[model samples]
Target: MASKQIQCEICFKEYAVGYCKTCGHIGDACVDIHNTGKVFQTHSVIMHEAVNVHEDDRENPKVIIRDASEERCKQHATERAIFLCTRHDTMICGRCLHSEHLSCGKEVVDLLREVGSIDCEKVNTMKSLLMEVKNEILLLKDDAENSKENFKTNADNCAQECIELGIKIKQRVDELTNVLIDEITKKHNENESTYSRITRTYNEKITWCENEERKIDQFVHNNMAGYLYLLSRKFDKGVSDVRSNLREIKHKHTFKRFEFKENRVILKCVFEDLEDVCEHQDEVTGSDDGSVNDVFEPTTEIQKTRRELTALSHKAKEYLDKSIKERLTVEAELKRTKADLNRVEKEIIDN
Candidate 1:
């Protein structure tokens, strides 16, 4: 019977055992050079692409392998690999090169010599990738900035609208208040003359009484005998004097105190329930305090403006949320790109 043979995926060399007998791939293929077709080759036509970028790293690709047919560890990107060749054409990280090939103090390949022979196409590809990454970062910045400015503008506009509404409401209130205050002044002024006339009449009557009382007290003290003589002429004279003093007070108008009546806390209740101010006007209003009346409340306009502001706020929030999500995604890509760039730069330096 013929012995079973297995082919090495890298060089397509058939071997009788599991591992590649010539190169050093053990059980599994590190890279499918033909299938992936993403390696840089020495030939001008190109055996594959310059780098082996995984699907996960496509947005911000890292060079997992450098040369065509050069295999790298895709599973453990931090510990990538290379194709085993006597020509030492594979490109690998410093750690992998040391641990995998040169750990035994074998002075096999000179990295300094290899650097001069690096393909110009590889450098160009790296530059193109980096340029794309740069554009992505800039786009992210612009999005964030625009989001901030738009949000700020919306916020300011909403605030200004509210302020204008407040000013308008204040003006209306002031107008209503002025009308009420003017009415109060007119009503109160009407009673001014009556108040003055009544006060003056009262002063005159009190003056007459004061004078008569003093005279009475003097007479009583001076004529104690006359006070006991009930039918004396002195008593008749005293009665006549009292009649003379009261005669001036008689026929004068009686006075009633001037007052203004308030109808509960109607104004307070009206103002508190501003939305219902007009509806409750009948309940709030009285006989103008029997002194003449009024108030205005801006409820509908305020509510309308508030609703507009709320809508603006919601729109701004959505924009901000979208911008944040976009920024986060871009930033992640940027980070990976930068790491890839660093890896490429280090490889260049080491080579």
Candidate 2:
């Protein structure tokens, strides 16, 4: 008898059915695994009760160990199988009948001495299954061949899409840049027209003031009080006009300047978006969430910063543009002061 949990001498694996009566080697014990043969009997009831065992069935392989081609029980590797589990509807070993049926308790375990034989219908059904499996294997090989072609096609499409998308992005950026340039040009032309108009107005005012000064100089030999009184009202009105023009230049006639602000974060996000698209092509579908879209819709803090910068630039431009205007306004004020001084001198003479 073969002991439990011992290695099979033929396959060198743990567990076997029984030892040969002649050679004493377990599992398929013939001249192929051992050097002995010529067995007259089999030892099937070593630890199990002999059921349906007969003397006339000595040469048959059905009872196991009666012939050398006895198959091992696939369900029970370490024990003789004679029990049929009622719950699972499968054959199990002698140990399984006493133990649990898949740990469902021994109450559901049952034993039956069932027999199986291949008739014409059974043979035909098995043949059909074998053919179906063979055809499926051939179809699997066809899929393997088609996979290479499909991969190449998909790769080429991906490469073309990448290049086309890159070109579109470049064109989009160029179009946006041109729009900004056009805006700057339009503003520049408007500012130029305004500056030219202001300059002509200032020139006309200067001419009027110069004429008044010449008249006052010529009236020096006349009755001093009477001449000075006639000129004071006219002089005051002229000074008021010059002061109003200077105030307009200071408050309303400023040229709004535009500055190009570079957002590195936008460029960084684009690069990262591209990388993310490539990393998970199957997951990341392209949406309209480009970085340029947010550039026009600036955050409140960013808009505030831009406004502050523009204010600073306007101040700088004012300083640059008012260099000549400052001199003109000061000259007009000085003329008013001199006229007052002249009137005082006349008053002193009269006293």
The per-model lDDT (C-alpha) reads 0.54, 0.62
Stretches of candidate 1 off by over 4 Å are 1-69, 72-147, 185-192, 207-351
How high is each candidate's TM-score? 0.29, 0.34
Give lDDT: candidate 2, residue 184: 90
* Among all candidates shown, the one with the greatest lDDT: 2
lDDT per residue (tens digit) for residues 284-342 in model 1: 12144643123445335335444587799999999999999999999999999999999
lDDT of 1: 0.54
